[model samples]
Structures are given as C-alpha cells and as structure tokens.
Target: MRLYSVIIPVYNRPDEVDELLESLTRQTYNHFEVLVVEDGSSKRCDGIVEKYTNKLRLTYFYKPNSGQGFSRNFGFEKAKGDFLVVFDSDCIIPDHYFETVEKYLDKHQLDAYGGPDRAHDSFTPTQKAISYSMTSVFTTGGIRGGKKRVGAFHPRSFNMGISKEVYQKTKGYKITRMGEDIEFSIRIIELGFKTGLIEDAYVYHKRRTSLSQFYKQLHFFGRARINISRFYPDEIKLVHMLPVVFTLGFFLMWVLPVVSPVLFFIAFTVFISFFGLIFFDAFAKEKSLQVAALSVGAAFTQLFAYGVGFLTEGWRKLVKG
Candidate 1:
C-alpha cells in the first residue's frame, strides 16, 4: 500500500478545519497521513487538531503567514509519503476517496492527478446553487472537474496529488497566490510529468457560504486566469474569453437601447434565453425549483464578476507592459 500524505493549509477557519478533519477520520483506506499547516491564523485549529490526535495520523504545524500555495509547500517539505495530496480546508473527504484513488493508480500510470468537487448533501441551498453554476456545462462547460475540458486536464491544487518525485523536481508552487495552482500545473506538464483527472476521487468542496462570498471568490478566480496567462501566454483560449464576452455583451444590452432598440432587443433576448437555459439545466440536475431559481443568479454573478475581474486585471497587465 502506497502511503499518501494529505496536506491541508488553513487560515482563520477552525470550524471548517474541524469539519474537514472529522470527515477524514471516516476514510475507508487507512494508508494516509494528514498534515494541517496553519498559515499565521489568529483563530488557530490547534485545539481542533487535538481532537483528532487519536482518530487520524495527524500533524499540525504553525508558520508565518504565507498564502495557501506556500503553506502547502511547507507541508510538502515535511511529507513522508510516496504521494503528497493537497486539499483545501473547506472540503470534506468522502469515505471511499482513497480506496478509489489507490484502485485507479494500480491501473493507470499518472504521476499527478486532480479530482472534481461536488456540493455535499448537508450544504446550504445557496452553496449547492453556486456549485451547480461552477460545474455546469452552461457556465464553465464542466471543466473544473468535468470530463469535457478545453485542453489538457490541468490538475488543480484543491484536489490534486503528485508523486514525491514530481515535488522533488518541481519544488511545488512558484508564486504564493493568484492562480498559483494553474501555474504549478502548467509547469508540471511542461516538465513532462503525466497528469490526469481522477473522476471517481471527487471531494465535497463547500465553497463560500453566501452568494456575495461566491462572487468575490469567482472574481478572484477570473483574475487568476489572467495571472496564469502571464506565466504561459499560449494558455489563453476561447473558453477563457467567454466570460469577458458575456460581461461586455451584458453592458452592451443596455447601451444598445440608446443606439438602436432593435439591437437592444436582440441582445436582451439572447441574454434571457441563455439564463433560461442555465435555469433549466440546473433544475434538471438538482430537481429543486428553489435551487434552480437561485442558480440563475449564481450563474450571472459568476460570469459578470469573473468578466469584470478579467478585464480589470487585463487592463493592469497591459498598462504595466
């Protein structure tokens, strides 16, 4: 049995860490060690980690505030496993997660892998709606963990794992934040490391609790996409630009009325039809009217916020250039 070191970087989120730790205790496979790295958080999880001392092979480390990427690197430095796995603090590991990964690895020869995220049954309706928009084909084309990706599947850090050799060669993340995962994944591929998606090894990712928080998170994600493009200019694809087009078209809809009512009517119709599609798709997947309704708002918030962030950061990049 290959040992897996699970590294979780936490900030001021003790409650979330507690929940995540509790979930890890139920994993069916027992060949994993958990490392909780505290990144200069005031509300520490030391007390919470104490609770799991007997339940899991767990270690807690406190370090000065470096962003999540570097905090993960700190964990990577101390990992004593054949493979190092990274998970966000705001995630719940399913009981069968490791068993599925071990089974898959026995057949495939991937040096690194990433898995999709789903909203847990216990998540709030808003959280589920946000998850739908994030993973929906109508929005992100299900690329985050979906089978239909734009290009090569770049394993994200949230549910990513790599062999100890990969870390020894690449030395983990380069930048501390702003799309660090994307940058690291690109480097991993560039270094000729094999990467793939482990579809069955998904995690229950409880993203932001509220729509406003979700918007902020997506907005930062949009900026991060542009940030990744800085490291790998060729990575910018049509799929990434779709949000910008949506945002620009949204503003054009209102401005078009001043120029020509026909143009505005056309844009308005297209926007409404697109959002209607999102609503129906969400309904089909969730089977809840309330969730479907909230999904529309979530989708809009996602696209608009991401678009604005993309444009905002792109302009800054251009100015600096």
Candidate 2:
C-alpha cells in the first residue's frame, strides 16, 4: 500500500478543520498521513489537531500568513508519501476516498489527478442550491467535474493529487492564490505530465453558507480566470465568456423597455425561459421546490457575479497592460 500524504491549508477555520479531521478518521483506507498547515490563523486548530493525534497520523504546523497555494507547498515539502493530495479546509473526505484513488491508480498511470465535489446530505438548503448551480450543466459548472470537459482535465486543489515525481520536477504552485490551482494544473500539463480525473474519489465540499458569500466567492473566481489568462492567453476559452454575455444581457434587458416594447418582451421571455430551465433542472435533481427556487437565485448569483468580476478584471488587465 502506498502512503498518501493529505495536505490541508487552513486559516481561522478551526471548527471546519475539526469536522474535516473527524471525517478523515473514518476512512476505509488507513495508510494515509494528515498534515494540517495553519496559515497564520489567530484562531488556530492546534487544539483540534491534539484531539486527533491519537486517532490519526497527524502533524500540525503553524506558519506566517501566506495564501493557500504556497501553504500547500509547505506541506508538500514535508510529506512522506508516494502521492501528495491537497484538500481545502472546508471539505469532508468520504470514507472510500483513498481506497477509490488507490484502486484507480493501480490500473492507470496518471502523474496528477482530481475528483469532483458534491454537497453532503447534511448541508443547508442554500449550500445545496449553491452546489447545484456550480455543478449544473446549465452553468459553466458542468465543465468543472463533468466527464466531458472543454479541454484537458486540470486538477483543482480542493481535491487534487500528484505523484512525488511531478512535484519534485515542477515544485508545486507558483502563485499563492487567485486561480493558483488552475495555473499549477496548466503548468503540470504543459510540462508533459499525465493528468486526469478520478471520478469516484469525490469529496463533500461545503461551499459558502449563504448566497451573498457565494456571490463574493464566485466573483473572485471570475477574476481568477482572467488572472490565469494573463499567464496563458489561450486558456480563456469560449465557454468562459458565457457569464460575461449573460451579465451584459441582464443590463440590456432593462434598456430594451425604453427602446421598444416588443424587443423588451422578447428579451424578457428569453431570460425567463433560461431561468425556468434552471428551476426545473434543479427541482428534478434536488426533488424539493424550495431548493429549486433557491437554485434559480444561486445560479443567477453565480453567473452575474462571475460576469461582473470577469469584466472588471479584464478591463484592469487591459489598462495595466
């Protein structure tokens, strides 16, 4: 059995760390070691790590505040495993996660890999709605973990793993944050490292608890996409522009009423139909009207916020360039 080093980078989220560690304690494959890297958090999880010392092969390190990408690099430097895995502090690993990864690696040869994230049954309705909007085919979320992606599968840090050789050659993430994972994944692929998706090794990712928080997160993500394009201009695909189009159309809808009533009605109907599609799709998957209704808002929040961020950041890049 290969040792898998699980690296978690956290900042002022002890409660979330406690929950994530508790879930790790139940893993069916027990050959992994856990390293919790505290990125300058005043509300540290050292106490929480103490609780797990007896239960897991756990180590806790306290370091000055750097963003998550570099913090994960710190853990990777100290890992004792054939494969180094990165997980966000806000995630709960499924019991079968390691087992599934090991099984997949036995048959296939991948230098790096990533898995999808799902909302746990215990997550709040808003969280579930957010998850739907993120994973739904209606949004760009489909390309994230969906089997058929726009291009090569770029492993996300939230649930990503790489062989020791890959890390030794590439030296982990270059930037600390702002689409650091995407940037790292792109470099890994460009370096001729074999990267792929592990479908069954999924994690329960509890994203932001509220729609407002989710909006901010997505807005930041939109900006991050532009940041990635800075390093590799061709990384910006047509699919990424959908949100910007949606945002522009949203503003144009209000303007249409003054221009012509018929045009306004046509635009309004098109927008309503799109949202209606999201509502029914969410309802079919969630099987709850409340979640479905909230999903519409979540979907709108995801696209609109992302679109605004993309435009703002794109403008900044243009001016600065």
Candidate 3:
C-alpha cells in the first residue's frame, strides 16, 4: 500500500485538534503520517498536540500566524507520503475514508480525487444550508459543462486528495486567505491533470455553531476572495459575484423601498423564497428549531458577508491598481 500524508492546518482550536487527532488514530488505513501545522496557536495547543507525539506517526510544525493556505503549504514541504490528503481540523473521517480514497484512485488510475462532505449530526439547519450552498456551482465558481468531471480548477480542500505528482507540478498552494483550494485546483488544471469525484468517500464536517461565528466565517471568505483577486484577476466572475449580487439585492431593496415598495417587496420575497427552497431541502433529512434557525441564518449571513467582502476586495484592488 502506498503511504498517504495527511496535513492538518490548525490554529487556536486545541479541543478540535484533539478530536481530529483521535479520529485520525482510529483510521483503519495504517500507512499514513499526520502533520499538524500550527499557525501560531497558543502555548496551550502546543501542549495538547505534544501528547499525541508517541501515540501516532505525527509531526507538529509551528510557523508565524500565516493563514490556512500558507500553513498548508508549510506542511506540504514536510510531507513524504506518495499521496497528500489535506483535512481541516474540524472534520471527522470514517474508518474506511482513507482506504476508500486509496482504492478509488488505484482502481480508477486517477491522480486527484475529491469527494462530497457529509454533515455532522450536530449541524444546525443553517450550517447545513451553508455547507450545501458552498458545494454547488453557485459558490464554487466551476466552469460549466455537462461533463462528469467538475472542479478541475475549482477544487475544495474539504475532502480532497492528490498524488505527489500534482504537488510537484503545481508547487503547492499560493499564499492567500481565501479560495486557496479553488486557486490551487485551477493551477492543477492549468498543469493538465484530470480530477475525479468519488461519491462514496465522505468527510463529516463540524460547522460553526452560532450566527456570529457564521457571519465572521463568511466575512473572512469574502475578504479572501478579494485577496485571491490580486493573483487571478478574472476570478471576479459569477461564483465570486454571488455574494456581491446578494448584497446588492439587499441594499437595493432598502434604497428603492419608497419609489417602488410593492415591486421591491415582491422581488425580495421571491429571491429569498428561492433560497428558502434550498434551505428546506437542507433540513428535509433532519428537523429541529436550532437546525431551522441555523439553516436560514447560514444562508443569509454567508451571502451577506461574501457580498460585503467582495465589494471591499474590489475597492482595495481598484486602489492598488
């Protein structure tokens, strides 16, 4: 069996790190090494990660407070596995996750494979909606085609794995605060590699629990998109524009309320209702007040943040140019 290197970038979440480490130790696929890249987390977390030193083939590296993309690049330099699989600290993988990934690639002769992320049992409806919305073409900014292969240049690191060949070709992730996965995937595609999606390999993601946290998450994501624009100028298109559009829609509803209240009200309702359909679908499999609230809040807050952030990004880019 070829060895797999799992690089986890962590900062300020010692508890989640412990949970992730425990989950990794339970993996049935034993031929892997774990690299915990600490992005200037507190001393407390350093102590926590140290406990796992003897338990597994784990290495901990500390860098200044760089963001996830940069931290991941740091970890990649230390990895020696034939395949590198990146996972966030908030995820819980099944025992068969790595085994499935390895087999899927070997059998299919695929160099890169990405899978759908499963929701954790604790996710509220809003978190679920946010997760689902982010996965679809609306947020992902994928090139549209009916082809079975999507996300060639729009890869998400949530549950993605790639061979060392792609890594050497792409030279790891560019240092950015947002859309690092997407940008990296774009480079991978530019370098000419085929990406395959594996439906069965799922990683359960633990989402943000509160509305405040959700908004901040989107705020950063939006700002990151702005940061990414510095590198990929044309990336300002639709998938990146959705946040801006939603923000504009909300602003216009208020700005034009007096002139055309009826039309504005109807347009707002229809727009929200369309998203509401997606929210309902998110909660169809599960039900609860917390879930319902989260579903709505997740959608609104994320779109709001993304929209606001995109404008901020655009303004900054304009000034720089």
Candidate 4:
C-alpha cells in the first residue's frame, strides 16, 4: 500500500477544520498522513490539530500569509507519502475515500487524478440545493460533476492527487489564487503528466450555506475560465459560454413576453418546464418544499453569478489589452 499525504491549507475556520480532521481519522484506508498548513491566519488552528494527534498521523505547519498554492507547496516539501492529495478545509471524506482512490489509481496508472464533490446527507437544504445546481447534468450539463464530466479531465485541487515524482518534476502548485488549480492542471498536461478521474472517490463539500456566499464563490469560478483561457486559448469551448448565454437569455426571457405575448408564452412555458424538472427532482429526493423552492433560486444564482463574473473578467482583460 502506497502512502498518501493529505495536505489541507486552512485559514480562519477552526470548527470546519476540526470536523474535517475527525472525518479523516475515520477513513478506512490507513496508509495516509494529514498535513494542515496554516496560511498566516489570525485565528490559529493548531489547538484543533493537537486533539487529533492521538488518532491520526497528522502534521501542522504555520507560514506567513501566502495563497493556497504556496501553502500546498510548503506541505509537499515536507510530505513523506508517495502520493500527495490536496483538499479544502471544509470537506468531509467517506471512510472509503482513499480505498476508492487507490483502487482506481492502481487500475489506471495516471500521474495525477481528481474526484468529485457532493453535499452530504447531513448538509443543510441550502447546501444541497447549491450542490444540485452545481453538479446536475440536466442543469449545467455536468460541467462540475465527475460522473458525466464534459471536455478535459481538469483535476480540481479540492479533491486532487499527484504522485511524488510528478510533484518534483512540476514543482507543485505555482499560481496563487482564483484559478490556480486549473492553471496547474493545464500545466500538468502540458508537461506530459498523465491525469485521470476517480469518479467514486467523492467528498462532501460544504461550500457555502447561503445563496449570497454561493454567488460570490461561483463568481470567482466564472472568472477563472477567462484566466485559464490566457494559457490555452483554444481550450475554451462552447460549454464555457453557457453561463454567459444563460445570463443573456435570462433577461430576454422576461422582456420577450412583454414585446410579443405569443413568443413570450412559448419561451416562458419551455423555460418553466425545464426549470420545474430540476425543482421537482430536488423536492422528490429531499422531501422538503424549501429545498424545491430554493433549488430554483440557487440554479438562477449559479447561472447569473457565473455569467456576470465571466463577462466581467473577460471585459477586464479586453480593456487591459
């Protein structure tokens, strides 16, 4: 069994880190170590790491405030495992997460790999709704989900892994914020590093509890698309344009009805039916009217937020050029 180093860069979230640590201690795969790198956070999480000392093979390091990319590289420098795994502080992995990853990696000898994320059963209705909007194939055509991934297998850092040899060759994460993970993945591929997807090794990503927070998070995500485009101009695909198109269509959907009732009626009915399908699916699974209702708003917010962010960043680059 190859050893794994689970590196997590944390800042200002003691409680969430504690929960994540506990989940790690419960993993069924025992050949892994956890490293928590403090990114110059005012609220130190060292005390929380101490509590898990008895149960987990954990290491804690503190460095001056740098971006996640730098912090992850810091951890990798000290990592003793053959595989380096990166995760956000707010994620919960199942007991079989490493087992699932090892099994997949053994079958497919990729230099790096990434898993998917979903809302846990214990997650709040808001989180679940947000997850639905983020991952639903029928909603966004599986841009974020691993099961039916579209386009290239761009390994996300939140649930990503790399062999020790690859890390040494590529020098680990170089970019700092926003789209660092994506930029790193692109570089990995460019360097001839093999990458694959571990669809079953999913994690519970408690990304944001409120719609406002979710909007801000995705807004940056949308901007990342433009960031990545600078590196790989032709990699940007039609699917990347969906959010912008949706944003434009969203406004037109409201205006078309007023201008021409016949066209408006036809468009509105089609839009509502498609929207209703997602809502009903959430309602049926969650058995909560609140989840159903919030799903609609969440879906809209996801599209609109990403759309605006993409356009905003693209416009910024255009102006700078």
> In terms of lDDT, which candidate is strongest?
2
Candidate 2 residue lDDT tens string, 221-294 = 99999999989999998889999999999999999989999999999999999999999999999999999999
- Encode model 3's per-residue lDDT on 236-276: one tens digit a residue: 66556777887888888876678888888897897778667
lDDT of 1 by residue, 1-321 (tens): 999999999999999999999999999998999999999999999999999999999999999998999999999999999999999999999999999999999999999999999989999899999989988888896678898887778998889999999999999999999999999999999999999999999999988888999889989989998898888899888888899999999987888988999988888999999989989989999999999999999999999999999999999999997
TM-score of 1: 0.99
Q: Residue 20 CA error for candidate 2 (Å)?
A: 0.5
Candidate 4 lDDT tens digits, 1-321: 889999999988889899999999888888999999999999999999999999999999999989999899999999999999999999998989999888887788999988888889899989989987877776577766446767668898889999999899999877788789988988888899888888898999998999999999889988988888887787678887888988888789889866999988888887788789988988886788988889988988988898999999999989995
TM-scores for every predicted model: 0.99, 0.99, 0.87, 0.95
Model 4 TM-score on a 0 to 1 scale: 0.95
CA displacement after TM-score superposition, residue 95 of candidate 2 (Å): 0.7
* Candidate 3 residue pairs in backbone clash: 125-291, 125-295, 126-294, 126-295, 243-307
Q: After TM-score superposition, what is the CA distance of residue 206 in candidate 3 from its true location, in Å? A: 1.8
Query: Which pairs of residues collide in model 4?
Result: none
The window of 10 residues in a row where model 2 has the poorest summed lDDT is 140-149
